[model samples]
Target: MNSVFTEDTKTGDIIIQFPAASKLFKEYKIDFCCGGNRPIGEVIKSQQLEDKDLIKVLNIMYEQMQTTEEIDWMTMPLTDLVNHIIHHYHAKTRDLLEELSAFVSKVYRVHGERDSHLKEVYTQFFLLKDELEQHLLGEEQRIFPKVMEYDLNNSLETLEEARAEINILEKEHEGAGDILKKIRQATNDYELPMDACNTYRLTYLKLEELESLTFDHIHLENNVLFRRL
Candidate 1:
């Protein structure tokens, strides 16, 4: 089937153009966040992924995803992008982390005796929360304002500085992604045991939500905002 995107299309560009593509890429374990600069074909080949006409499959999925709710982040102004990131991702992440920390702590304390995995889950999550807190603080206080200023002035020096700072942020993104993968493994993809209580179930559910949010957050930063920088 003829598709709007080809195997030669960059992974990030494919995601930017098709909202359904991100879910497909994530389901295939394709790194559409930090490693999104390469072509989809190249990424698949490098990862040794074998798929039967994945591009056709994606095109079919996109046709069904007819909702107009998705934002045109690619063509959006840099300042608007920054504002959206802060409001949508940063603010929500802070609130989620706050609520999730209480849930994770309660689960780890109450159920860690029964399930050894909770210990690892607890460790990895707090580590992630800490890193994300610092990362958000850095972005809000220093990086984001610089980005808006750069956007406003079109100054080469500001652009260069933003680029340098975003390189650091990309490293942070990789670290967070790594921690997220570790959490997923520790929980075996948020599987719940038969003896699980309400808190335990809730903890796993929230973790899954956080995982999805973090993936979307990182993709927006690494693939969308950072590219524009």
Candidate 2:
């Protein structure tokens, strides 16, 4: 709020000034801690972030003056919240994967001969994308709907059924978290080479975004969704 850092300021500028903002960014797995020197616009574009939604959230934060009080993340229905995450975060992940896939392929084709690391990173990105896509589908088709069903039902039979489902979902969450960590590590914590081309830079940015989305995704399920169960 009150422009923690000016619109022109890079993420690095105000991260130190606004500990709350920095914490929120870190919770979302954003690179404000490490890549804070980059401009917000550049960072957002690299991460394939939905500018409109991000801006809306920022406006809400500005109005609230603190991240904790900005949005009642717990108040929303599980189904509605799941839908929002899918539409905003998961869909963006799909798009970023596609973009990254193409970007990596092109970069590898053109620069892989000179930079062997590109090939390795490209392979890792592809593997990570496929795993993440499968994970998203599982949540949408099975885990989310069942969780919502349980939340809506008050009967003893429903409660028993939901408990069983919740156990399976929690295991899936653990597995997903492991894969996400692998993805992060495979990208070398999303470090870009000094000679990185635009495509390489963009690819790292998307990886960072993916990490953030996964963090939020897991937090919602582990903290919010499971609490309801």
Candidate 2's residue-wise lDDT over 1-229, tens digit each?
4544444556644443343455556645555533455676666677777544554465456556655544555677767877887898789878878877887788789888986766676776777777778878877876666666766775556556556766666666566556556656756677777888787787667767766666556555555555566
- Candidate 2 backbone collisions, by pair: 12-36
Q: Model 1, range 1-229, lDDT digits (tens) per residue?
A: 4577777888878788886687778777777777777888887777777565677787787777765887788889999999888998888888889999999999989888988998999999999999999999998887888899998999989888888788788899999999999999998877889888898888888887788788888889888888878
lDDT values of the candidates?
A: 0.85, 0.64
TM-score of each: 0.91, 0.64
Worst 10 residues of 1 by lDDT: 47-56
The local lDDT score (0 to 100) that residue 105 gets in candidate 1 is: 94
lDDT of 2: 0.64
lDDT agreement of model 1 with the native? 0.85
**Total backbone clashes of model 2?**
1
Runs with alpha carbons beyond 4 Å of true place in candidate 1: 43-52, 64-69
TM-score of 2: 0.64
